[model samples]
Target: MREVEVSEITKEIAELCQEANFELGEDVINAFKDGLENDESPTAKAILEQLLENAKIAREDRVPMCQDTGFTVIFVELGQEVKLVGGDLEEAINEGVRQGYKEGYLRKSIVSHPLKRENTGDNTPAVIHTKIVPGDKIKITVAPKGGGSENMSEVRMMKPADGVEGVKDFVIERVKESGPNPCPPIVVGVGIGGTFEKCAYLAKKALLRPIGDESPHEDIAQLEKELLEEVNKLGIGPQGLGGRTTVLDVNVEIYGAHIASLPVAVNINCHAARHKETII
Candidate 1:
């Protein structure tokens, strides 16, 4: 078995938090460029250009692409053959987030409580999801999810009879209702099947997939394509000014569910899709 130190995890998470906030992924940049090329409206094209410029400036200046640095969401894949030492795993992760946000100059957006709202001061207590696997290597992914897009996300319990068409309709309606709130030219992550909570988690996880990558399943991939086409047809366009680039990509992740339940969740991400992954 391989031994991994908690200090290492903390150090990496700290760096990743800053990196993700500063460096926009190439896939996202390409999506915006493609959107600009295909968009018919001059206003939409201009908006896409500005988004691209913002990403470039963020990278060069080592600054956040968006003002909202977002809630730190960490995905960890722990290997059964590995051992962690030096500190509490969760605390290490939270410490990393604290240092990352503070040292990197990213905004501290986490609140200590829901109703009795107060800033957590350092963006501590990151939302961490851990999965056990067979290998000795651990994979860590940092995704900074902003509130504008996240607030627009939703889950619905649909009748089994609703089927694929109903699912498609629900997703489209949600996007329509969201309009420009989630920031248009968005990436839509749709999770179908599983329980309500599982479906929501699946949808959020789906956003981690690289933009334009299709699901391994052919039917699911086709559905993603259909959703993308239909969503763009809505003419919400870039920043909802009415154009042809309402969505950059549509990703659907599915899982097996009970015979009676058909739960679906939609997670939206704005053009500034920020995530970084490292394996150690």
Candidate 2:
């Protein structure tokens, strides 16, 4: 088995945390440019332009795109054949987040306790999800999720017979209820057919996929297309100022569920869907 150092993981996470906050993905930037070109509302078009400019400035200056530099969420794909050496994996990850947040000058938003409401000082105890895969390489993804869009996320346990129409209605309704609160022109991640908790996890994980990339399954891809069209029709526009670009994209992730249950979850990401990944 190959040996991997926990310190390396820490270093990688620190770099990823900084990079994700500073650089908006090319797919997101392109989406804004496309929105500017196609949106008919002058106000929406201006907003799109500003968004693009903000992204450029963030990258050039190595500064966060938004004031809320988000809670650090890391997705780790560890190779089964590789063994971690030197230290505890989770602790190493947390150390990385602490160093990253402090050194990068990103906002420290995590609280030490839920009810106590004390700050964590540095953003430690990052929300990490680890999976074992077949290869020898480790893949790490850092997605800094902001509170505004996350607050707009929802999950519902639906009857088995509720079906596709039910899901569409629920998602649209959630977006309608959210309105400008989650920030408009959002990316909607829909998870269907899983258990209550699994559905929520899937929805959050679905946001990692690039905006324009459709699911491999034809049915799911079609659903994503339909949802995107329906959501944009809401006239939420850029920053909810009223226009045809209500959502940048709709991504649907699905799994098999119990015969008696059909659970659905929706996770929303704002215009600055900041994430970065590295393989080691």
Candidate 3:
């Protein structure tokens, strides 16, 4: 069996948090570039340009891409054959988040309570999701989600009979209602099937996918493509000033349903799609 140090995982998470905040991923940057090229509105083109320039400045200055910085969310895939040494895995992850947010000069956006809303100074206690995979390597992905787009997400339980059309309609309607709230030219992540919680999990997972990637199943892939076209047709444009670049992409992931239930979730991402991953 392979043995891995928990401290190493902690250290890697810290670095990833900092790196992800400071730099935009190549996939996301390219998405914006492509959006700009296809953007029909002058305002949207300008917004895309500004976004590109901001990314460049953030990297050059070693500063965060956005002031929000975002709440720390980590997805970990641990190998069943590996044993963790030296500490509790979850605690180590939290320590990494604390140190990363503090030392990296990233803003702390987590709160001790959702209703009372007490800011958790260190951005500690990251929202960690761990999965056991069939390998010896531990993979971790950090996605710092800001409030602007997150607040616009929605979830619903559609009747099994409602089918794909229902999902398309709901997502499009929600995006239209969301309009400029999600910062426009967004990335839409849809999760279909599974239970309520599982659907939400899938929705978030969908966001980690590279832009323009689709589900392997042909039907789902077509659904993703169709959703992308429909969302862009909303014309929310860049920063909601009206244009053809309302959505950079739409990603959908699905699982077998209960035979009686269909759960759907929508996770929206702003123009600043800040994420990074590391394996240790």
Candidate 4:
């Protein structure tokens, strides 16, 4: 068995939080370029250009790309063959978030309670999801989600008879209703199947996938393509001012479901699309 230090986890998470906030992945940058090239709206083209420039400036200046800086969501893949040493895993992860947000100068937006509305001071208590996998190495992904787009996300328990058309229609309407609220040129992450909360988790997890990558299953991939086409048809455009580049891409992930249940979820990410992963 392999022994991994918990301190290492803390150290990596800290760096990931800072890095994800400060940079945009190459795939996302390329998507913006492609959108700019294909979109006919002058306003959308200008917005895409500005997004590219904003990413460049964030990377060079080592500053956050968006002012929100977002809630810390950490996904951890723990290898079954590995044993953790030195400290408790959960505390280590939260410590990483606290240090990372403080040192990186990221804005602390997490509240202590839903109703009381007390500030958490430091961004501790990250929403962590851990999975047991085959190897000895641990993989951690840090995704910072802003409130605006998150507020626009939804979950619907659809009838199995409603089928794929029902799923597609719901997604399109959700985006249309969202309009500019979630910030335009958004990445749509759709999770179909699973239970109520599971599908919601799946939707959020789907956003971690790199933009432009399609589902391995042909049928699922086709659904993603169709959803993207229908969403762009909305003409919500960049920043929702009106244009053809409203949706950058649609990502879908599915799980097996029971006979009666067909749960669907849509998680939206703004133009920033900030997430970073590290394996240690």
> Model-by-model lDDT, in order?
0.92, 0.92, 0.90, 0.93
> Which digits, one per residue and each the tens of the lDDT, describe model 1 over residues 67-97?
8989899999999999999989999999999
- lDDT by residue for model 3 (46-124), tens: 9999999999999999899899888788999998989999999999999999989988899988889989989889997
TM-score of each candidate structure, all chains considered together: 0.99, 0.99, 0.98, 0.98
The candidate that achieves the highest lDDT relative to the unseen native structure:
4
lDDT of 2 by residue, 36-106 (tens): 99999999999998888999899999999998889899999999999999999999999999889888899
Q: In candidate 2, how many Å is residue 92 off?
A: 0.6
| Weakest lDDT window of 10 consecutive positions for candidate 2 | 176-185
Count steric clashes of candidate 1: 0
Quote the positional error of residue 208 for candidate 2 in Å.
0.5
Kindly give the stretch of ten consecutive residues in candidate 4 with the minimal lDDT sum: 117-126
Instruction: Give the distance in Å from residue 233's predicted Cα in candidate 3 to where it truly belongs.
Output: 0.9
Stronger candidate by TM-score (2 vs 3): 2
lDDT of 4: 0.93
